[model samples]
Target chain A: MSGTVLTRTALGAVGVALGLYGAWLTLSRQTTAQIVSTVQYLVGGVVLNDVLIAAAALVVGVLVTRGLPAVVRAPVVVGAVVLGSTTLLAVPVLLSYGRKPDNLTLLDRDFVGGWWVFAGVVVACVAVAVVVRVRRGAGGSEPA
Target chain B: MTSTLPTQLPGPTPEHFTSRLRSPAVAARVGLWLGLSFGVCFLTGLLSHYAQNTSQPIPFPTSPSWGYRVTQGLHVITGTAAVPLLLVKLWTVYPRLFERPPSLRVRQLLVTGLERVSILALVASSIFMLVSGLTNTASWYVWHFGFRAAHYGVAWVAIGSLLVHIAVKLPVIREALLGDVDDTHSHDRATAVDQGVMSRRALLRTTWLASGTAVVLTAGATVPWLRTVSVFGIRSGDGPQGIPVNRTARAAGLGDDELGDSWRLTVTNGDQSVSLSRADLAGMTQRTETLPIACVEGWSANGDWTGVRMSDVLALVGADPESDVTVSSIQQNGPYYTVNTLQKNFTGDDRTLLALRLNGKELDPDHGYPCRLIAPNRPGVLQTKWLGSIEVQA
Candidate 1:
C-alpha cells in the first residue's frame, strides 16, 4: 500500500477501536433503563435533525426565497439560519424549563427579551444588506 | 458522467442540489473549523472528566489556579462555536444523501456502508453532545439517564467517528482546502451554478459571524468581562456572595437545624480525630485567598474566601501537610458532590481553605454557610459546600 493508504488505514483502525471502546463504556456504565433512554436520545437527535429540522429548513429556504428578489435572498436565508440557531440555543433558558424556585441564579437572565433584540438585529442587518444591494443597482447580477 | 443505476427514487436527488455554496470547498472550509472546535472540546472535556474522577492515577494539578477556568471555558466556547459550523457542514453535505453508489462492487458497497455508519454516529453523537451540553448549562434534566456519564461516553464516540470521517475524506478535504473557495471545478456538482445571491466565500463569512455571535452571547458566564453581552449566560455572576451558587442550601435540602449552632467540623486521620466548633474554627489563624469558583458547567466567579488553611486543619489531627483529604458536605440531597477528595497538591497549597467567609462577610447559606472547601484549580462541585467532616488519608 502507498504511504497515504497506510496512514488512512492506521487512522481508520484507531478510530474504529476507540469508537468500539466508547460504545462498550456507554453500555457497561449505564443501567438498562438508562441505556434505553440514552439510545432513544441518540437516535432521536439524528432523526430530528436530519429529518424534521433539515426538511423544515429546506422547505422554508425554498418557499421563502421562491418569489423574492435575488438581491435579498442570501441575506434573508442567512438571517433566518442565524436567528433559528441562536433561538434554539436560547430555548432552554427562555422557557426556564429547569428554573428552580429555590435557586434564583439558574436561568435568571431575561433571555426572551435578549432573543427578541438579537432577532431584531439579525433582521435589521438583513434589511440593510438588501437595501444596500438594491441601492447599488446590482439586481442579482453580482455575488454578495 | 451518467450512472446506469435507476433514478426512480421519489425524493429529491443530488442533481436537485444546485447551490454553488453547497460545494466541497465550502464543506471543507467550515468543516476545518468544526473539526478544530470538536478537537478542543473533546480534549478539554476529557481533562474535565479526568479532573472530576474519584481516583486520579496521576493527581490533577493544583497550580495555575485558573487552569480549569481556561479549559472549561474553552470547552463551552468551542462547543458553542461548533453549533453553527456543524449546521453549515450538514447543509453543505445534505445533497450527498440522495447520491447513488457508482457501482455495485462488493468492496464499494462495504466502504459505502462503513462510511454511512460512521457519519451517522458522528452526526448523532455530535448533536447529542451539543444539545445535552447546552441543556446542562441551564441545569435542565430532560432525560432520565445520568448526564455526565452519557455525555462523556458519547464524546468518545463522536471524536472517534470524526477521526474516521477525516481519514475517509482526507483526499477530498486536502484537494478542496488547497484550492480557492470559488474554484468549484471538480469538487462541485456539474449542475451547481452561481445562481444564488451569495457566493461560497460570503456564505463562509456569514457562518463565521453567526458562530462568533453565538460565542459572544453565551461565553460571559465564564469570561467575566463578557457578562453584560452574554445575555444568554445562565449565571450573571450574581449570587448571595460575590460569586454564583450552583446548588443552593435550600435546593440541597439543608435546613437551619443542620447549619445551626450545633455544627462541628470533624477532622480525622486513621487512628486520630479532632472536632472543632464554628467558634473554635473562628479562633484559629485565618487566611484569605481570592480564587475563582469555576464550575464544570463553565460559569465561574472569583471571591475572597477567608478561612483556615487545609494544612492547619489537617495538623489538628496530626496529619501531614501533604495528606490527601476527603472533604464531606452536610448536604443530604446530592450523592456524588456530598464528598470530594482533595489531592495532596490541593491540601499542601496554602491557598486551599475551608472558607468561612466570602468578600469580608460570613458565607450565606446558599454559598455554603458555616464553612466550605475552596481549593485552587478545582471544579466548583468539588468545593464541597456545607462542611460535615474532613478525613485525612493515611
Candidate 2:
C-alpha cells in the first residue's frame, strides 16, 4: 500500500529492464553487421542467449518477490542495474540516430524498424522495473 | 511468492504447439519480411522524391548494373512470400476475435484505444493492399477501379496503422524481444491459476519462437544451396524472367514491330529548335544494354534496349547533364509519365539504357519499343516506354 510499485517485485522487474536496456544500448548504435555477429559470438547461440536472459530475468523476479539480500545479490544486480541504467541514458542518442535519418533520403526504414525493436524492449523493461521499485523498494535485487 | 496466487497453474499443453496456431504465425513473420520489402519500395520511392535521380537531363551512373534489380527483387519476393503469409497470419491471429477480448484499462485510454483501432485498420488494409496488389499484378480485378490510386490510398492506411500498433503494443513487444518481463508465461504457470491463464506472455513467447522459424524458412527460401535441404519446398521458379508473375504476352495483343519498320525515337527540347531523330541519335553513338526491368510493384522481365543513353543523346543536343528532365511516352492510354532529375539517371549508371529489342528480338508493340528508357531499380512508373521526347526545363 506504500506505493503503486511492485515492492520486492520492483527489484526483480528492474533487473530485467536493465538487462533489456543494456542489450538495446549495445545494439542501437551498430549500423554494420558486426553487432549481430558479435552478439552471435558473445551469446554463443541465439536460442541459448534467450534461455540465459529468460533464466536470469525469472530468477531476479523471484528474488524481488522474496526478502531483500544485500551481500550476494547486490553486486550482480548492481551490474544489471548499471546495464539497464546505461541503456536508459543511451536511448535518446539511439532515437536521434533514427530521427536524423528521417529527413535524409539515404537512410532506410528497416534500420528504423530494427532500432525501434531494440529500443522498445529497453523501455518496456524500464517500465516494469520502475513499477516494482515504487511498490516495494529495492528489496530482492538478486535472482541468483 | 504470492500467498493468494496458486502455485499449480496448468502449463501450456502440447496442443498449443506452433502448428496448431500457424495462421497468425505465417502472417507475423512473413509479414515482417514482406512488410520490409514494401518498406524498400516505399523508401526507394521516398528517396527518389528528394534525389530526382531519374528526371535529370543527364544523370550519373551508379555502375552496379544489378543495383536496382536487388531492391526490386526484395520487393517482389517479399510480396510473393506474403501471399501465403497474410493468409496464414490472418488465420493465426483470428482466434483473438472470438473470445471476449481483455480490457485496456491498464494503459492510458485514449492513446491506447486509438492505437488499437488503428492497428486493426492497418492489418485489415494491409491485407486489402496485398490482395489487391496480387490481383492487379495478376490483373485479376474485374471492373478495374483505379487500382494504383486505391493501392496508394491503402498504403497510407497500412502505414498509419503500423505506427499505432508499434505505439500500443510497445510493452508486449519489449518483453517478447527482451525475453524478460515476468514468470507469468503459460509454460511456467501452475495448474491452479485460471484468472490469469490467458496471459499474453505465453502467446508472445510462441509468436517469437515461431517468428524465428518463419524467418529461417523465408531466408532459406531464397538461399540457393539451402534449397537442396528445403523440407517445406516453398521457393518457386517464379516467372520466365525468374521474377514472379504470369504474363500472357501473346494475349496482351503484342505483335513484333507492330508499329511497323518506321520506328523513330524523337527527342524534342522545350525550345523546339533542337530535335533529333533515331538516326541522328544513332549516328553519334548507340549503346545497347540487355537488362532485366524490375518494378516496385514486384514484377521483373528482361528485354534488350538499344539506343543512345539519355545522357549521350542529351549531350548530342547540348543539354546540361545536371538539370532536371522529363521523359514522356508515346503510349498515352495509361498513366505513362514520370519526371526525374538528370544526375540520378545518366550519371553513368548504365541502367538508363533505351530499349530497341526484347528477348533477342525486336520490341513488341505492347512492350516499350523503337526505344524506351529501361532504367533499372526504379518503380514501374519510372520506366518510360515509347519514350517520345526529352524536354529540358529549369
TM-score for chain B of all predictions: 0.97, 0.63
For each candidate, the alpha-carbon lDDT, in order, equals 0.87, 0.44
Compared with the true structure, what per-residue lDDT tens digits does model 2 show for residues B239-306? 33233322222332334453445545555455544555555555766666766655444334555566
Which portions of model 2 show Cα errors greater than 4 Å?
A: A1-144, B1-63, B83-95, B98-116, B142-145, B180-258, B270-282, B301-304, B338-351, B357-367
Q: What is the interface RMSD of candidate 1, in Å?
A: 1.2
Model 1 Cα displacement at B296 (Å)? 0.8
Error of 2 at B294 (Å): 0.8
Question: Is model 2 an incorrect, acceptable, medium or high docking prediction?
Answer: incorrect
Candidates' DockQ values?
A: 0.73, 0.02
* TM-score per candidate, chains pooled: 0.97, 0.50
RMSD to truth, every model: 1.8, 18.8
A44-64 per-residue lDDT for model 1 (tens digits) = 988878899789878877876
Q: How would you encode candidate 1's per-residue C-alpha lDDT over B1-394 as one tens digit per residue?
A: 2345536547788988888878999999999999999999999999999999878889999989989999999998999888888988998999988777666677877788889999999999999999899888888888877888899998999989988998999999999999888886877899888456577777888889889888999999989899999878888888886677778888888888999999989999998998888899999999989999999999988889999999998888889999888889987768787988888988999999999999999999999889989999998889888999999876
Candidate 1 scores a chain A TM-score of 0.93
